[model samples]
Target: MRRLALVAALALSANAYPAQAQAVAETADPYIWLEDIYSPRAMAWVEAENARSLAVLKADPQFAGFYADALKIAEATDRIAMPRQIGGQIANLWQDGTHVHGLWRITSPAEYEKAEPAWQTLLDLDALSAAEKANWVWAGADCEPTAERRCLVALSDGGEDANIQREFDLATRSFVSGGFTLPKSKQWVSWETPDSLIAARDWGAGTMTASGYPFVVKRVKRGAPLEAASEVFRGKPDDVFVIPRTFTDGAGHSEVVIMRGITFFEAEFVRVTPQGTTPIAVPRKSTVTGLTQGRLIFQVNEDWTPAGGQPISAGSLVAVDPAGKAAPEVIFAPGPRQSVDADEVAVTQGHVLAAVYDNVRGRAMRFTRTASGWQQSVLPLPDNAAISMVSSDRASNTAYVSVQSYLLPTALWKVDAAAGTAIQIKQTPARFAADGLVTEQFMATSKDGTKVPYFITHRADMPLTGTTPTLMTAYGGFQISYTPAYSGVTGKLWLERGGAYVVANIRGGGEFGPAWHEAGLKTKRQVIYDDFAAVAEDLMARKITSPQKLGIYGGSNGGLLMGVELIQRPELFGAVSIQIPLLDMLRYEKLSAGASWVGEYGTMANPDEKAFWLKTSPYSNLKPGAPYPETLIWTTTKDDRVGPVQARKFAARMKEYGLPYLYYESTAGGHGAGANLKEKAMTIALEMVYFQRRLMDTK
Candidate 1:
């Protein structure tokens, strides 16, 4: 019945849009019923749609092979056990053939460094899920500070962002009876101590914000009911979210902080003490990276002028003794084309390791406190690669850094902060034959004359032709940097099968820090779309790939990019893969978590922003008879981030207007589209198959 309903809706929607691109009317929409997520009727429609999509895609000749190889790659036992330091022991969450849902296990550092570590499982998600008949997904644990053993374990059902946190003992390796337990809701929690906690979650009624996140924080003591917990801090319902975060420095100094996320990139940090909440006098664009030596260390993303001191640069790392009366001191500052990597800071005992990028190349520095003041020295590391901090702790000067490039498999390095020395710990075994793969950087001139950098990975001997089947992707939003990293699945499934890949580092990202992102924010967002289209056009101009063989893919914000480009520049692409996207820009604010992103994407309530969205919104501008590539639109029913409704509405609208599009939605996996390894592998296979059919295989 649901399938027939969709078919009927498609027939009506085939001509849903106006002849000219114009502001869409709410009255024209015919598939708002699909927005009822998880209702039996809506789910029935989803199941029928999934069945139809599976029947078609699974019958493709490449489907079986892609699935087999992806499953093998996912289930491979030899993959590195990325170690997480906990309680002076190495912990890891692993999933393979033996353990499908994954096993949170622990081992010693010495044992972990060995080829095959004897791992002791602390929690088996698969077994627990089976026993309870619930789809239990591990969200991670926040442990006690002193012992770092007793923890508050977070578990989500069906992979929702909202989850239930329960306390567990690491010594006994079991959930303690009558332990600290918070009922399921989107929350922020931290251990005030073993006997008490600081948290913000849905208490009863009107506790969550308009965006479905907690706005009030409370102190819940052991053995006390949630309602009896005293309110510590409260935020307005319109704010993004309020979080209670506990930061512990190397010298046994700890600070309880309340982070009020006013916008996506803007936040306010306040110190919570016995007296009350005191606001920290830092720029709203600054982040408290880590604490060290009783000094609050953070990276400033906006030009900040203290009460009386001169201004600090936008991309400078600064340290301040918040408890003292000393002025803020800039620790490190990057020059013209340099920016600190967003996720590259790690705090070790008495030291902070930072990775900075210049012209898309990586460099590291170690900052240590001295008698006079804090000082920094360069740490030896390879350039022209993406480097990340895998694991680090405040207990010791031991940290792990993983480095990789487009062609290079990731290699882990253990860095000693005291000596500023690093040693190779492990290198991933190459999953595919890469005798002569070339990685080259190129720049495309955007419409606004901004130079956008991109990476191309292809066979070294391949000719400069306009017919290579190239898959291009980009994500240009939210100050997130897109760096070079090795992907086993991409190599084994796509590259080995004679496909070239390109990654475009456009504006609205932290590629060159705050300034680069600022240029593409809100009202100036068209430059980001223009940057992506310019890269695609540049690829064709360089004879790398032409429209006949070019495919593009992106998820989340990237998916929105795909949508905009699909409508605005349809002739440039042969295939489009949009996963978990936002399409209905006019009504986006009312969608799940849409109101929270108003800073990144301007609210439609404003006249100028509404006009801008009306002119360029993919959903609003999708008119009938427009030339568009055969597109694949996939999402998950459990996705609470962008939600699955957007995808459903877009597909239904496309069908209404008789456009070429494919739609599929998984029942679980939340925002990512899968819960277990097999589920993820299948989605990958399906996506690759779609690309192969459009760009590689002769139809």
Candidate 2:
């Protein structure tokens, strides 16, 4: 067993913090050695912990059945091949039992509309991995703007975010000899031209940010080595990642824009030209989605009033020309109850398609810059479902969208933005039985009297006996909205087994736009946790389920929520699954990519923020004899984004306190767990088994 405390004090530099606070925080933490991710002691401990936990969980009578079912669903060839319009073809990365790594394939738009599209394999990752004797994962491919023949293909080793970019030719179906090949590193790259590349990675010493990301952008010619690359732009080392993106419109108009991330939610954008880089006027909390008709289309998250200009409210889509010839136009300003889905916004040849959540439900709108002004019209699609833009083509007014509800499988819709017409093209075959299941939305008032909405899916005839085994989850951070989507695994594994599931749209999320998220930032985050706990209590109040029958799970930021809930509201849940969590708030900034999130979670260097963590940090709050539920804590060794150190230290501290817990860390799989389909299936199956044992098994 590991010791509870170490001998040496944790030294925080005087420059980084106040002397007194640094001295106070220097007190020994037992598992600091776990921070050395590949150290011998850490690996040994992980091995033993995995063996111990797997022995019990895999011994469950239903584990094999659960694993088989999950695997079947994961590797099913009938699964929908999600398509993206690229280079005049519909491209998709498909994985099955045979193609574990995946097969990057492409088909024509006409053939893709059919039930069984004729796909030609562009890259066989499995064969490539086998030949190279390396575990390669397909990241993505970026094609040149005009010709769309030469492309930069990114491949990750194992599943880490850091990858190598190799220039490949679509015409020859092979990698270009002596072409642009960037070594493996956490980087961002875009084509400056057919002969030159603009990139940001680990250029050399003093080039990386504190967040383990590249802050320097450089331009490399076709035959130049990385060392010979010339500096194009330089951001501060304290800043987050810097990216140079090129946007092209239908009229052969192309613009290269460089973004220097001041923080996670803030940035400075500049248009790069042969003359010089010029500042693109936009709010700090705004993103330039694309360039359409020489106009930069962007969405602002904060209300802005320009100098001698009209005030634009928060959550508004607007466009501005780089030439400053035309005044800024408000494409779409969301209503009070409407919030734009940032990930769903796309620019096509003749229109800008954006998906917005209206009162937590989805609606798609098309914005076109007409002679009069910007005209907005709602796209004709299924309502009461989560609608999202899948892909859009800049060469044509063709796009694809997806719609899915809690009970409805996902369906693909092809839209003609020019004609304002949409048709359902393809849909996923139902993986599980949903005939008897129903979904309903409910609202629960938080401790501060703020109403939070949540959705529950269960049998229509469920009795109000408060005995149903229920599992609830929520991600209440990062300005991300948790919308309704069909989950075949949850429906087939849990719902089919007489269990109910809940999704709480609590505070600290973008459900109602920036205001809703900013309402729970920093010390005000207690309300987000309160909203989740309130939803659990509301379920009990409605006789849906009791405390002993309730389980909750989340990953990444959501994992942090689970940790807080396990400490703050232990009696409300039977099991808590914290996956790839950030537990040690005091030291989170020192971990991988953690410093980038200071915009969302405040830094400990601030006196008030330090005080808040002292009270709310889960690792610091765990006691010897708390009535805590046995937690399923899991993370990946290759999770370079959040890093596994936080999870490891938290679990080690739990052990020191003699608390009930289970820890499993996979050797691969990066931020999102499981390197391959089988691994992912096993992880899901393990969760199902653990939930069944903790929440459903009545003695």
Q: Return the top candidate by lDDT.
A: 2
Candidate 1 per-residue lDDT, tens place, 284-362, comes to: 9888777887777888899999888878999888887766477887778888799996468888988988888888878
What's the lDDT for all of these models?
A: 0.85, 0.88
lDDT against true structure, model 2: 0.88
Model 1 RMSD in Å is 4.4
Error of 2 at 397 (Å): 0.8
Question: To one decimal, what is the Cα RMSD in angstroms of model 2 from the true structure?
Answer: 5.0
Query: TM-score for model 1?
Result: 0.96
Per-residue CA lDDT of candidate 2, range 603-669, in tens?
A: 9999888777766777777756667778999999999999999999999988988999999999988
For model 2 the TM-score comes to 0.96
Clashing pairs in 2: none
